[model samples]
Target chain A: MILRTLRLHRFKWLLLTGYLPLSLLAAALVGDPVRWEDVHWLDVFGEGGGALMVLTWSLLILGSRPAGTVSNLLFIGLSLILVTLWQDNLDEFWTIPDAQLWDTWLENIPMPVGMAVLTLGLVRWYEEQRVLMAQLSQRERFMREHRSIDPVTRLASADYLNQQLAIELRRARRECSPVSLMMLDLDGFDLINRRFGAHEGDRLLQAVTELLLLNLRDGDLLCRYAADRFAIMLPQTSEAMADLIASELTSAIRHFAYRSSKEGERVTVTASAGVALALSASPEELMQRANRALSEAKQTGSGCHAMAG
Target chain B: MQWRDDSLEATWRSPDTPHLPAHHHPALLIELAHARGIPEHRLLRHTGLFPEDMRRGEAMLSDRQYRRLIGNILEYDTGGELALVWGRQSLPGHYGPPSTQIHNAPNLAEALNCLHHWRHQLSPLLTPLWWHNRQWCYLLWTTAGAGRRGPFLVPAAMAAVYGLARHRLARSLDWHFLFAAPRPTSPQPYEVNLGPTVRFGAGVDMVVLPVEDLYEPWPGRSQTAFTAAAHEAERVPALNGAGPTLPEVVYQSLAAHPETPAGLDDTAGALGLSPSSLKRHLRDYDSRFQALYDEVRLHHSLYLHQVMGLSMEGIAERLSHGDRANFRRSFRRWTGLSPAQYQRLLPE
Candidate 1:
């Protein structure tokens, strides 16, 4: 999978690989090999290792990200750092004539230029993350831990929801505010999977996740609780408020009109929700209550929402 | 004499039984993982099987390979719903003769009997043994040779049974499921697949079907098809050993004579085996005599305490415990909870 992602950075990799031979050719033409005793093994190891480490970091950044201005800037910045470090390491093995002021300039000029470019890349990367963080506010809150993100929908997993719920419950206790948890499940999701295969089912889920995320409020958190169930944590929301939001979510899913990626066939889906208001209850208890309510709503019919007493 | 010995081996399904169809149970796991976009090769990685072999329907997997395949799928299972989904989709399966028998059974009772009779072919991983009281029929789900994957496989097995019955009966059966494992992180899978009457952290894994529903007539009852399928199923050879597994034999001995607090030697003697040989057999099944003994003892103790409403002292005396404190300590050791605390988790 990482290799698949790295395939997108072929040009960057080609440039990096091409640099190695060119630099070797330049050093061989302009300088002579130093005596074995004159070579400082320690300096060679440090500079060579530093350059290799920078190369790995550059490769990782390129592999994980798509081709864009930010990625290009990062690639260019890291490439310069790698080049300067490589030339410095090259100095340990070859002795250029003292008349070679250009070699000194080659090492010093790119070092400061690379540092500036890296700083610019970092600023852009930070800006990119800020925009993504806004889009991800409903999926996570307070902090982001990559381990907790579900691979399918890219929403937070149930365990992450519980962690945030505990923190929210603690805050609610301090502020004396209401907190609610709503569990929404796609109706007959397994049937859809059985009919169209799991690939299409996964695509439908990804589509539904986007719809739910779009409908959710900024502070409210949405989590993939289980197979077809999603849990939304509502802070400062009462049962009545949660019920309204639950209906809205159910309707949004009901009217989603998701088209299967394989056949482009229209697949209509509906969701049922179980909403429970927190009242001095632990996270587990609150989740169980919401689950029970959701089951009841599902038992009644699709596109229905129920509130726990 | 050789024929008799072979028949005895055929009476029980030992862990090494390679009777499970490659394209059936293991294929279902492969399909479920594949549906979530996990490649077939990844699911079959290190299991030494291929999609072509499974598709050809010529390959058979032993309990060991089945365990490995399940482990691989679970390694990629981020949502933890694969087992439940696999279970829900497993019923009325494509396992040749046994599946044919199930789909044509006259009633729920007949369908269950067919499953029990052909368990080696139908459910090689987990075995379903059932009995009835006045009000309810208790279907005990025992791990045939799942070893550490027992808890995961049991739910799937139960879900498969529940789904098969529901499909044939054309109505949802009220199955009160008791799982030996603790409640999971989420209950939606159990609720959606098995229904709401699920109790976790029980002493044993079982499904409590009300007797009234057991004899309910199935809609697709074909007498001719049922008999023909049964005949075909009878012709199907045993995968490995066909009777109760090594653990099942030990469980029966321990459960039957719960009053003795039978040590390994005594239980081994009852099964007509020497202690060391019995230990070796249990080892082959990935089990220990002590674990099976503890499980059976726990099963009885819970049954006595919960159903018979026996107190700590009475239950201890019944299990041949010399003192109440010893029983309390042992119960705590077995369940990691004192009797009172454990009972608190039970429903009133």
Candidate 2:
């Protein structure tokens, strides 16, 4: 993945490489080799270390991020800072002519200028993250772990749900608030796979995830608990309120007209949900209760069932 | 003389015997992975086969080749749902008249009987053996040279059976699943596909169902179609090709005389073979009589202790262990944990 990203920034890589020769020529033209006694090993160590760290940061940004405004800005600012630090480290080895102050200006000017550009890049990055966080609100709660995201549905996986449930339960306990979990499963999902194919089934899951996210409140978190089953974590929700939300979710999915991309046939599905409100039960027990209630709902052909702990 | 045919069956055909039709399980698996965007070559890599092999009119896969195919698919599988999904699509599948026989059964009980009777054709990997007590019926899954692929194959086979049962009944039946394997990191597939009443790390792999549920008539039963399908199925040879493998036969004999604890000589005599011949036949399937015996004994002791609610001393006495201490020692050796520790690992 990193190699692919780096391949996309060939021009940026060329610019980064050009810095080496440019700095070398500038230092060699107007500077004399310093005496061995005059060399400050301590200063070289500090400045060289800073330059190396900044280079690493720039490479990481180039490798992980797309060639967007934020990445370009961050890359440019770090490169500038790295160039200045490289100049400072070079001064310990080369003694510049007294009349030539360009080397001194090179060390002094770019550092502060780079700081300003870096600040601007950080500000833009913060704004970009806010928009992404809003979009991911349904998938994640207070934590973000990329590994926990499901590849097919782009939703948090069951492991993430377990971790978030633990935190939510603890917070609810301390704050004396109710936290409810609703387990939702699409009815006869296997039939859909058998009819169309698993690819269509995966697309249907992604569409259903979107539909569920649309119906959820701002604070509600939706996770893909497993294949064809999803879990919603609702804080400060009572059992009655949970049942209401569960029914809304069921009705939303029931009405969704998912078109199969292969055949373009309109396939509709209903969902069964089981809601459980936390009292003092452990997270595992609470999840079990919700899953059992889901089984009950499925058996009885109910839209939703609530179990109060 | 009685053992001549059995011994010959074992020696002539090993795990390398081409028992499974390429179009059935192998094709179904390839289709599933292909739908999920996995290329056919990747799923068939190192399995010494090609996508075209499945299309050949009468291509077949030996147990070793099928195991390799399963291992390859599992390498690309995440979250462990592939096997369950495969199982769901497996049964009532197009093989021959047996699929029709299973599909046209009168009830879940008859459908299950068809699966058991035609297992050599339908489920060649694991042999399904069922028996019922007064209240509940137990469907036991015994391996037939599954080797290292047992874990993956069992769930898929179980899911196939469970999925068919649900489809026939149009509702989830009240059943409890027991697996002799450890619990997976994610149990959602097992719970979602097979319902939530599942237990792992049990001493046996089986499913327990209420006897009443078994006899409940499915809505789509057609007596004429069922009888016709059965009559047609009889003309087709058992898909295991040669016959029952040695491991399955050994498992049956050991399971039949669980309390008596048959010695190698006794079992060999029962099968009409000398002890060395029986031993060599089992080795062909990558199995041993002692391993099969230990498995049966372990299943019996755990069942008595956990399911039947027998105490340690009572179980030891029933199994003919002289004392609780010897039973404890044997149990530890079998499961790597004391009986109490094993129980602790079990789900409530």
Candidate 3:
């Protein structure tokens, strides 16, 4: 059994290693001469590298691409070119054995035929590579954007919010526009953890995140600030508008049925939020003021919203 | 400390289902049986194991039964090697072919790779191949039925094979480390049997042989035949219709003290059931309880004696003996040899 397993692995390697060498030798035996019957020797020299250039280019192509149909096609093309060069090189060495001109026939037809087939393969390969690269680029872009989003709630994280805040703050300053920050924290989150369990607590947080996102305006940005806390950045909005949005968020959380594991037990979940105007302060300072008001609201009771002083 | 407290409570409140014995871990039982030369049927009889019950492969014997069996074996077997040898042989499939393949490998590394690749075919439930300290190689094989035996049997088997293979090669096993992560049991057996020096539960079941052993061509096929003879040296007939059922007095005594020398005379004297009459009743169930008791006690004793490190005196006490001397005499009479001699023959 062990020997068979070893042989199987060895067989795979042997297939991979032998294919290229055998292809190259076969091509060499049937390739056409580099110096064509009608073309001048100086034309080949003027090309600077001739058949060697093709060899170098094929090596480069093999090195750059992963193993696939494109590589296989390129390898076959290169092998044919190499074989043609080898046949042309042989003409400089041995005389023809028969008057039948078998060497001329071997040197003339198969090399060009192989090159034509290889060219067709290369065209298909190029088209396939183009589609593959497009898919790869789209995947890379999605991954890059996904890094900024929260995994659990699919909302933006604090880092993303801060970047958006900086941009909105700059635009507000330039255009004499206004922006407001609304920070909300869940009430009795620790109590919920103690009562139900961490898994349920996580589920409740996800529910609240969805509620807040639904309550916000299309232009507003919602982000998770800390455990059981979230911030919404509303652009071109006044403190009064932010407070109204905060109230809507509070009401939604209050009405949400956070089901407990215990039968017939449903907890009325609520949030305390605070709104701060970015009228005469930087985005960071505005965020700090909103956080202070949120803390104050949380201390007072559930469903309370306070404005930054 | 808090976790331990929780576990203790959980263990106490846990259901006493036949599948989850309070004391005997099935993995440990199989391990001990395999380690000791005692047959599986004998081990089963002592533990009150019904082959049909174990069909699902999760049936467990009570802790009391496990402890009694281990204690009995230790008291009866002094050399402490039989359990280990039994463990090696009970491993599913023939070890000879694999051992041969590994022995003929160019190097220890290649030999281990071979064992790793092919071990699954031998026992599907057995865990994948694992290494310990770069010297020892370990593979786990699930028994015919799952959860019917403990992992202690694996280490015993490994230790035995390591010792025997080294001896066969005429070199020290040269293993620097050994480890296994078998299912947990209350009283650990590997610690006592393999050695105080070797580590257990580091990761997986493993045997630590010298790296050079891979290059050594396995001793000729003749060595395989010799090993087979040594392995099968203690073959005991499966006790069929040879033991009492639970309702009978002899059955009660045997269950109460599995390690008690359950001779026909002794059981007959206690129950007022003449030896002949008792045998007749046992025949109805297709078993004699006394023979069942001996088989069970033999298996239990080997495990306790070799794996659990229980002293002979302690085992004798558990077996309900009046004294240690009597237990020794009885043990000798049952097996045709002294407990110490039997233990010495076990794999180290």
Between prediction 1 and prediction 3, the one with superior lDDT is 1
Residue B78, model 3: Cα distance from true site in angstroms: 57
Cα RMSD over interface residues, candidate 3: 25.2
In model 1, the runs with Cα more than 4 Å from the true position are A170-177, A193-200, A236-241, A256-268, A279-281, B1-17, B36-39, B74-80, B104-108, B164-179, B182-201, B208-225, B235-278, B296-348
Q: After superposition, how far is residue A24 of candidate 1 from its true place, in Å?
A: 3.1
lDDT of each: 0.77, 0.78, 0.52
lDDT tens string, model 2, A203-295? 889899889999999889899887889999998898778878888888888778888896778998889998888856687888888998888
Best by DockQ: 1
lDDT of 3 at B193: 28
Query: Can you tell me which runs of candidate 2 are displaced by over 4 Å?
Result: A14-59, A79-119, A302-309, B1-8, B15-23, B27-45, B49-61, B72-80, B95-98, B117-124, B182-185, B221-246, B249-289, B298-348
Clashes of each: 6, 0, 49
RMSD of each: 4.5, 5.5, 25.8
Grade the docking of candidate 2.
Answer: acceptable
B23-104 in candidate 2: lDDT tens per residue?
8767888877776557787878777776676797477777667767887877775666778888887878877877888888
Deviation in angstroms for B48 in model 3? 36
Native contacts recovered, each model = 0.31, 0.41, 0.00
TM-score, candidate 2, is: 0.79
Best by lDDT: 2
Write the residue-wise lDDT of candidate 3 on B1-348 in tens digits: 000011111011111122232222244445434333455565555666665655555455443344344544544332323345334333222333444444444444454454444432222222223332234333322221112223433454465445334433543243533443422321123322232245443332345444456456654435454345434422422111112112223433543445545577776666676788766655543344545565446545544554456778777887646487887876775555577765543335
Instruction: Specify the highest-TM-score model's number.
Output: 1
Chain A TM-scores, candidates in order: 0.93, 0.89, 0.55
lDDT of 3 by residue, A38-106 (tens): 445564453324556766766566655556565666666665665556445444433334453655665
Error (Å) of candidate 2 at residue A244 is 2.4
